[model samples]
Target: MECPNKEKNLNRCNCSYPSCSRKGLCCECLHYHLRNRQLPACCFPDDVEKTYDRSFEKFAELVMKGKI
Candidate 1:
């Protein structure tokens, strides 16, 4: 089934990974990243997201640094 809010979701999506199949699919994106021991790009700031370091450790470090 198609996501009802795909277009809207895309507007707020900060993922910079080109050709990502889960671009506008929030649930799938979250699941895929979590399964790989990482967080989705949208969880981080745009600059940070661009680094493609979505690991849980990175997110924690950002949080600790009050940058999230």
Candidate 2:
């Protein structure tokens, strides 16, 4: 989709998924994750993101624990 802000977004994206096609494309990444009932890795801490558990439940848990 040729995101104009891709390089800039990449600097802040913390996704650890090695082969993510939407790595720097925030819109695509968010839509993709939401369709799967998950949040993109950018919503999580690096430690948590690396676990590949981007579920809504996980995000809630982290929020409740003040970990997000």
Show how many residue pairs clash in every candidate, following the order shown. 0, 0
lDDT of 1 by residue, 1-68 (tens): 99999999999999999999999999999999999999999999999999999999999999999998
lDDT of the structure predicted as candidate 1? 0.97
**What residue pairs clash in candidate 2, if any at all?**
none
RMSD of each: 0.6, 0.6
Report the CA-based lDDT of candidate 2 relative to the real structure: 0.96
Per-residue lDDT over 1-68 for candidate 2, one digit per residue giving the tens place of the 0 to 100 score: 59999999999999998899998999999999999999999999999999999999999999999997
RMSD value for candidate 2: 0.6
Measured by TM-score, how close is model 1 to the native structure? 0.96
Residue 63 in candidate 1, Cα distance off native in Å: 0.6
